[model samples]
Each structure stands twice: as C-alpha cells, then as structure tokens.
Target: MEMVAAAATKDAKRNGGTPEWRVTVPEGASVTVEHERCLAARAWGWLVSCVVALGAKVSGSGKRLWKIGADDPRRAVHGLKVGLALSLVSVFYYTRPLYEGVGGNAMWAIMTVVVVFEYTVGGCVYKGFNRAAATVSAGAIALGVHWVAVHAGGELEPFIRSGSVFLLASIATFSRFIPTVKARFDYGVTIFILTYSLVAVSGYRVEALLVMAQSRVCTIAIGIFMCLAVCVLVCPVWAGQELHRLTARNMDKLAGAVEACVKDYFADQPADGKQPPSDKAEGYKCVLNSKASEDSQANLARWEPAHGRFGFRHPYEQYKSVGAAMRHCAYCVEALSGCARSEIQAPHHIKQRLAGGCASVAARCALALREASSSVAAMKTSWALDLAVAEMNTAVQELQSDLRSLPSKLVEEESPAAVLDAVQLFTVTSLLIEVSTRIESVVDAVDTLASLAGFRSSDVEKDEASETETKVKQPAASDPDSYEPEKKHIEQV
Candidate 1:
C-alpha cells in the first residue's frame, strides 16, 4: 500500500497542472483510505459551495424580479410613453425638412430622451430641466470664451483657452461640494463641466461659434421638451408619491425587526439543543438599510411638484427630524440586540421575571411602530399614537421598577455571574427606555408630516374605518391569550 501510494504521488506530479499532493501515513496498521480528502473530494466540496451560492443568487434575483413586475402592473405605460417619444423624435430626423430645420442633430435629440427619462416622471422632469439649464448656461459661457480667444489670436489664444478651462473646472468642482447644489444640481454640474470642456477644446472659429452653439442647444432643448411632454402627459409616475410610500415601507420593516428582536430575546432553544438563526437578529439590518432609500427618495421628491393634492413645499423639513429619530431607534435596537447576544447566567426565577416585563414592553413598542407605518401610508395620523406611546412609557418604567425589585435573596447571592446578569438586564432595560423615547419622536414626526400633507380629522376618521375592519380580522389587543395579554402583571410591579 505504501509503495502504491508513492507511485500514485509520482505519477500525479508528472502529469499535473496543479502542484503535487503526496499522502503520508503513520508507519502502523491504522491506515484507512476512508478519511482521505483527495483532489476529487476537495473538488466536490468546491462544486457544492458554488452550486449553493449560485442557487441563492438565482432565487433572490427571481424574487426581486417578481416584485418589480407585480409592484407596478402598469410599468408598461411608462415604456409605451418612452417608445412613443423616441418614435416622434425619430420621425423628425426621418424627414428631410424638419431635420434640417432642427440643425440636423438627431443624436442630440435621441440621447436627450434616453438620458432625461427615468422610472418616475418627476425624475425625468427634474433631470430634463436641469440638463437644459446646464447646457444653455454652458453654451453661453463657451461662446463668450470662443469670442475672447478668437479676438486675442495666436500665442495669446492658447493661453486664454487653457486659463478658461482651468477656471471653470476648478469652480464647478468646488460648487458641487455644497450640499443643496450637490443634491439637486449634481447632474447639471457634471453636464456643465462636459460642455465647457468641449467648447474650450473644439477651436471653433469666430464666425461659426454662435451657429454651432445654437444648433447644440436647440437639439438638446427639443429632446428635453419631448421627454418632459411624454412623462407628464402619459401616465406620469410621481416621485413624491413614491417617496411617501417608501418611507412607510421602511417604517414597517423597522416595526417587523423590533418584533422579531423582542421574540428572540426570550425565545426557547431548539429541542436538539442547537440554535437556528434568529429571525429577529436577521431583521436588525433591514432597519438600518431603510435609511438610504428614505434619504434618496426624499431629496428627489423635493424636486417634484405637489402631485396627488398633497399640497406644495411638502414639509421636507420634518424628515430631517424623523430621520434623527429613526437613527436613535436603530441604535437602541443594536444595544438591545447586543444584550441578547451575550451569554449572561441568571437564576431561572430572575430570568423569568425580567423576560416577562421586557417582552410586554417590546411587543407594545412593535405595535406602535407598525401603527406609525400604517398611519403614514394612509396619510392619516393615528389618534391612538399618544396612548400607545404612553403605554410604552409606562411599561418601560414598570420594567425598570421590576428590575429594581428583583428578590432580596439575589443580593445575598453576591455571585459574579449574578452580577453580570443584573448588569445585562439593566443595559437592556435602558435601551428599551431609549426605544420608547425614539418612538415618541417618530409618532410626533409622522403627525406633523400628515398635517403638512393636508390630512385632517376627517381623513383620520375615514382611514380608521378601513383599519378597524383590518383589526377585527385579527385578535383583539385586549384578548387574554393574545400577544398583548394582561400587562397587569407588569403594571403591578
């Protein structure tokens, strides 16, 4: 067997693309081939892992595709609008007269529709107007530069051209750093730089400069106007509407994550003594990721007009505070999650008492967030928000009280393990208090948002009617066996 193994190694090294692997065994009778992890075995493991990763990738992509398809059944409306706009522009160049009349620059028009077009009509409107403004302003400046360079002539012309490029590039680069301009006029800034560079380098003669600039601007404007028309006139997709919806969805995800975290903190172990991935822990990141979407959409939404009768100027100021509140909520969740993750040995009795109160408070907190999401979605502020917040405040206070009231016997134990458990419990309780405060901020922010969006008492009442039906289908909050069961136990603490 040793001779055969030696021969196998020699043959493998002679024929191999990969470096040689030689097996060595103990000089005893314990040799077993079954334990060997040879090339075939390693290859099989690599193949399995690759297959698993690919399957997950494909599955995730499919689910995302389905959502995109189902979420907007009328997406084809935007597609039709795009196609129609493109075809109309195509007809201009297709004809002899109109193409010449429009300066014979079909690429400019076609590219404008393609670049200015977006999934949302408001996005197109915002980008198109910005692009045209940038182009015109850049064109005007370029023509001026051309005039100066032409009149200067010879050696001076090259120097002047270089100076103009450097000046414009430096100024534009610096201006893009400012927050407001960066948000709304970022695309414009980029286009301005591109246009200015081209004009400076193109070396247009004095006589042809104006004509060239005019043709470029005209073609771009036609494209912009065409795109704007199609977007507004043909099944417009409003960015503001989508922004509001996205914010609500984000709130809902946060609520779900809160619920999952609370459940996992006190969840029972598997029967086999192994722990599966906790649903709540998995949800923690979802709350964090929602922040980016909220920010992007809100900025874009501000550029949009007051559509769907939500009123003008849209109180974007409120989102800034709400985001602060949401971030606070996220930090509290992280702290609480950290506590649950650490292994702290506590007496079973103490564990039971702490968990019961903690669960009650957390569950109510989750409900409050879920309600907040629903209120924002319907554009109806909840009357119960104040009450729910009060409940959380009270529950958190009582939980603290209960923690303070942990049996006197625990004090006598004086064990380091008991001390760690007590410390962990306090840490988690403090996080809950912070969570309650942040939830209040969220509730207040949403109320202000609803009011700004033109919500009234009547709107709340109308929305509540539908929500009441939804609530009735589920168990009552006051039901004894429900998740909201008898806060009475914690109340007495």
Candidate 2:
C-alpha cells in the first residue's frame, strides 16, 4: 500500500500537480484506514459515477433525483441489497411452503420499501434511526393498549386504554428531546418499540404472536439499517451551514445601517450660508431609518436562521448578539438626531443690531438671521449630541459581546431575570454611546457655524466690555424741568 501510494504521488507530481494525496498508517493502530473507510469511499464514488452516466443518457431527466434517507442513493441501494440477502435467508429458514401464500409475502414487500425509504432520507445513518423507531414504537403502544382493553372485557372502554396509548405516542413524538439528555437516544426508541410490541402481543395466541412480532421487528430493524446506508451514501448536508449563512446575512444588514449613518453625516452639501429647510428633516429621517434597520438586524439574529432537520433544537446565539449591537447603533442615531433638532435659530434683531462685526451681512441685505448670542448656545447643544453618539457606539459593541455569550451561558433552568439583565445592559450601553456621538456631531456643526459667524466664546467678553463703557457714559436726567419741557415741547409740536 505504501509503495502504491508513493507511485501515485510521483505520477501526480509528474502531471504538473503537487503531491497532495498520501496514505499512511498511524502508530499503535491495529485497524487500517482502508478497511474502515473503504465501504464509504467505494459506495459514494460508484453512486456518483452511476448518476453522472445516467444523467448523460437521460439528458436532464435526472435533475431532481429522489433523495433517499439523507444518504446517497448508492448507500441506500447497498442497504437494500443487504436487506434482500437477509430476507432470503430468513425466508428459507423460517417459512413453510403452505404458509408462503399467507401474510408473509405482503408483509415482506411493505416492510422492505418502508425500511429502505426511511433509512435513505431520515438522517438515521449519522445519528440513529430514532424517528422511524419512535413512530413504530408509538404504533406498537397503540396496538397494545387496544389489546389490553379488549382482554379486560372492557372493549368499549376505549377511554381506559386511550391514556396509555396517547402517553406513549407523545413520548415517542418528543423522543427527540432524549437526544439532548443523552446523545444516543436511538436505543430509547428501540426499547420503546420492543416494550410496546411485548405488551400488545401478551394475550395473543402463538401463531398471532409470531406473525405480529416478526412483522414489527422486521420493519423497524430493516428501516434502521436502510436509513443508515442512505445517509452514508449522501454528501451529508449540514444544518449548521444554513444557520451560519443566515447569521451572516443579518450581520451584513446591520453593518449597512452603520455605513449609511456615516455617509449621511459626512456627505457634502451646498455651502451657502443659508441653511436649507429640508436639512434638519432629512437628518432626522436618516436617524429614524438607522434605528429601524438596526432593530431588524437584531431581531433576525435572535430568531436565528431556521432551516434543516435539526434547526428547531439548535439555538443560534451569535445572531442574537449581532441584533444587540444593532440596537446600540439605533440609540446613537436617536441621540444625534435629537441634538441636531434642539438648536434654536438666532434672533434676527440681534443680527440687525450688531451690524459691523457679527451681523453686518444680514443687516445690509435685510435677511433673516440668528441672534449672535444664540450661536454660542447652539455650539453647546451640538457638543452634548456628539458626546451621546460616541457613547452609543461603544455601548453597541459591548452589548454585541454580551449577546454572543448568551447561547453558551444560558441554561434551561436559569432565571429569566438573568437573561433580561444582560440584554438591558447591552441596550442601555448602546443608547448612551449613540447619544454621545450625536451630541458631538451637533456640537461640531453648531460650533463651525458659530465660528463662521464670528461668534466665538471670546466674543462674550467683548460684548461685556462694550456694555460697561456705554453704562459709564450714560447719566440719569434728574431735572424735572428738563423732563417737563421735553414733554410740553413734544405736545406743542
């Protein structure tokens, strides 16, 4: 085997390919890889080849070939071949010529097809034939309950036996849960079937017992092997892959929302001194959209990407974490939008009165303008918004981490409060971060406008000085005569 492998490696290298393939026996190992893996390799390879050949002959006729028991058809075929061999042996030893025309023929035919189909598609191979066994077990229980009620001379007492039958059925149905409790739950299903069959055949005569027991065992056992063979033959599609894709898609959407926020904040706009009427509205709308978009992503994460056979039992925790992050992003948008909108327009009179240094352009053109002092006020508002936006972003990242931890940390018996606490922390953290960033942006915009208008914090000092000088020059008119004359003169005029 080593020589053959070496020769193959040389041929592969000669054909302009790297020697990527090799065969080796591990140290202290009694079994060879060839013995353990040979059946699988041969079966899968042959099946693929057969399918290709069949497709070539049929010209697209085999596009939607029937999928047998999560297994490749070839594996299922192998199982059927084995089953047929066993059936022939059993028939030869267990049957008489006189009884051949009775129920045996029909039972074998039905059992064969069912067993083959179940094994091929039900994922019975990788795990065990639990589902098939569970169903059969439930059926057997129902039959037993019926028999017990009849034997008790309470044939009309369907109610008495109904409880046991239904309970067994429910147990069988939920046997999927047993896999969680114990990795090998298939044995439970088998035991359940056997027990139920034993109960149902308890009062039956020998002939009836033989027929029913033989049929039930044959169907269940055959089904189990057939499903295993089927799964082995197929490529074994993973449920986890679909879950991951869904998780990624949701995360991408969340990322897109963040990108949109960046673009909206940094995008260039008309540089005219006059603020556009729609500017505030557009900014606010973008903030709202960002919030909603983030929320959706978070929801997608929590629900997980549901697909495949085992998805119901699989908890997708990562998706939930992404969602928490998105919420933080939304909170940040809110803070930013709120700060941007809180800015008060400066009074036009202030612009008109301070004509030379601050409001000169507005006064000259008779244009609407903000009060000079209001510019400084707006700056402070923007600063607050910016701070909030920054905080919200930080919170989102934190919350995402917390959410990611949930799937691994959460236990079946854990208190709901624990989960809620984690979620709330992430949410609150994101909200604070968002609020900080938004405040910062608003502050920045306000400050820029203030600077552009020559309304700096230092300007307040200048205004105070000018006010002092004017007060010193002004004097109170203490003369009543002067005031009386001014009033009389105004009246006469």
Candidate 3:
C-alpha cells in the first residue's frame, strides 16, 4: 500500500493534477463493507420509523375526528345537511335550463349557501335575510346611480358614481357602529357595503348593469331560500332552545358549585396533615366563561320564530339578565374556592363551630337555585321557589348571627397565626353570605323570565290544587256538625 501511494503521488506531480492515493485492504475489506452496510441499515430503519410515526399520527387524528362526530351525531347531520344544500344549489350549474335561467350569475347562489348556511336554523335565517335584503337594496340603489351617471354624460358620470359609493358606503359603515345596528344588522350593513361597492364600481364600464344586478339578486335569493329550507325543514336546532337550555344548565352548575365549596371547606383533613389535592370543580368555572356564549345565543335566538314552547315575542333578553346574576354568584363562588385552598386555613374547631350554620345557608341557596333551574328547564313557574328563597334568607340570617358571635372566639386565640386563620375563615363565610344574597337576584330574574315568557304552573302546584279539592269535597266526616254544614253548603250550590 505504501509503494502504490508513492507511485500515485509521483504520477499526479508529473500530470500537474491532484494526488490520488489508492490502497488494497485485503484483510479488512469485509469489515469496511460491513460498516457501510450498517450505516445503510440505520438510514432505512430511520425512514421506516418516520413513516410509522406519521401513520400513527394520522390514525390518531382520524380516530379523534370520528369520536367527535360520534359524540354529537347532530354535528354529522349538520355536515350532511350542508353538503345536501350545496349539491342542490349546484344543479344550476349542471343543468342547461337552470344555467340559462340565471346565466353565469348562478355562482352567487352557491356562494350564498356557502356563507349563509349555519348549524342552527335561527342563524341561517338571520344571515340569509340579511344577505337577501342587503343585495336587493344595494342593487336598486346601484342601478339608480348608474342611470343618473349615464345621463349626466362621460366627464361628470365618474364623479357622480364615485360620490354615491363614498356617501352610501360611509353611511352604512357608520351605522354598524351603533349598538342596535351592530347587534342585529351589522352583517346586513357589511353586505350592503360590499354589494354597493361592487355594483357601483363595475357600473362605470359595464353596459348592462341592470341585467347583471338582476341576475345576481335572483341567484342570491335562490341561495337564501335553499339555506332557509334546509335549515328549517331538516334537523333544525333552534337558538331559543339552545339559549334556554344553556341558561338552565348554568343555574344547575352554579348550585353545585355553591354546595361543593361549602362542603369542601368543612371537610376533614387527611391524617398525614398534607393539604388535600385540589379538586376544584369546573362547574362554576364554566359559569365564569359563559357570558359571551349567553350574549351570542340570546342574539341568535331573537331571530328565531315561534317554536316549541317559545312564543314569537318571547323575552329572550331576560335570559341575559339571568346569566348576569349567575356570573355574579359565580364570582363569589370562585373567591370562596380560593379561600378554601388558601395557605392559612382556619383551625379545625373553628371550622366545626361555623360549619353547621354555613352548611345550612349553602344548602338553602343551592336548593333555591335548583328550583329556579327546574323552573327554567320545565318552562313552568316553580311553586316552591318563593318558599325556597325564604328558607335561604332565614339560613343567611342564622349564618350572620353566627358570624357576629365569632369575634369573641377569635379574640380568645393567643397565637397570631390562629387569628389569621380565623380571618381567612371569616372571609370564606362572608363570601358564602354574599353568594346567598346574590342567589335571590338569580331567582328574581328567573321569576321575571317566567312571567314574561308565560310559563305554566308547575306540576307541584297542580298536585297541591288537586289535594285541596279532594279535601274540600271529602267534608269533615269525623265531626257531624261540620259534615252537616258542608253538606248543606254543597246542596245549596
């Protein structure tokens, strides 16, 4: 190998090129080949691993999607409904007759379906109506502007058209900032601006502006109609029902959080003396984040027509009131939860001393909340709601009395740490009291909703009425004098 290398170097110098050295490794030849083979094997292994990992990720994603569809079959149904609507609208492009009817503007109908179709019927109706009305109004204004600009001749025509677009667009955009308009007709205003701008700008060059506007409006109307039909006729999810159900569910969750916070605060510590694992219930947390959902649902619900158990003019606004009250109570609950998990915990005996009163207040409050929830869910006035609120108030008073007597106990404690713990205990108690008080607001809101919505009397009221009637008809059989009076009264009637 040395001799061959020296010869190659001399040959490269004579040729005026780079040196090239070659060696024969007869003994290590198989090992060198084996090393190369090992590297190749590793590369192949890595490639296989990467492919396997990708396949696994894809499979997992697919399973998650399948699980989501399975969990709420309604989502799957909604997807199918959208596909069906699009397919039905697509016929305008596929069939010659339909194509001739709307011309190439049939694309507008497809676009409308894509943009307007929603999971809930109310949402679809809301967007569809806004789009259709905006298109027609904008188109009419556009055509009139175009006609005037054309008659004004070439030089002044451009200014007239530009000025109209700027004025109308600015007015429409400014209207969107208003509260009422922003809430309900914001989408309409946006559509109006888009339609007006498109038509107005295009009219500068297009000769047949009227025919184009007409075709587009007709196509959009067809799209809107298809969306409404599918949304209403198929598995329609009513926004009102969703809002109603969501409000009731939040009340139930609030009740659970109140009761759980009180119970957890008074619960016994483990023997090991370590703080128990934090088991914060998510129920009240959900209430804390529910404001936006409530607002959107209420807004969408207003667009919904009269449906099962809901009147055409049902007081959907009242639901927001109920939600506001709930969120307030939920804030207090969240504070109590933090107090429960605070580093300075009240002494066990102090907790014991206040436990009964606090538990009673919490229980009564939870009971009242549950009654209100049941009222909303059943769409009926709760017969026992007033009684429940009264009991809750009484419990609150008792808790207050207990709190008034707590200072003496705290004063007796010699250790400052013990006093601090008592202060924490008082904080928790005060929050509970505040929560109990706010629960009344929640109940009142529900009562107002029940009255405005014209909810029927609950089953409990009917049962009580039937019981009273039976008692009245039975007469006083044990007392002959009362029986004769009752019999005489009945005969007279």
Candidate 3, clashing residue pairs?
Answer: none
lDDT score, residue 249, model 1?
68
TM-score for each predicted model, relative to the true structure: 0.74, 0.30, 0.85
316-397, model 1: which lDDT tens digit per residue? 6566566667767887787666655555533445566678788888888888887787777777665676677778888888
lDDT of 2 at 408: 46
TM-score-better candidate, 1 vs 2: 1
Model-by-model lDDT, in order?
A: 0.75, 0.43, 0.88
Q: Which model scores highest in TM-score?
A: 3
lDDT at 417 for candidate 3?
58
Q: For candidate 3, what is the lDDT?
A: 0.88
Ranking by TM-score: 3, 1, 2
Off by over 4 Å in 3: 1-31, 270-280, 410-418, 459-493
179-223, model 2: which lDDT tens digit per residue? 443434544565565456444445243336545555555544544
**Cα-based lDDT at residue 101, candidate 3:** 94
TM-score of 2: 0.30
- Superposition TM-score, candidate 1 onto the true structure: 0.74
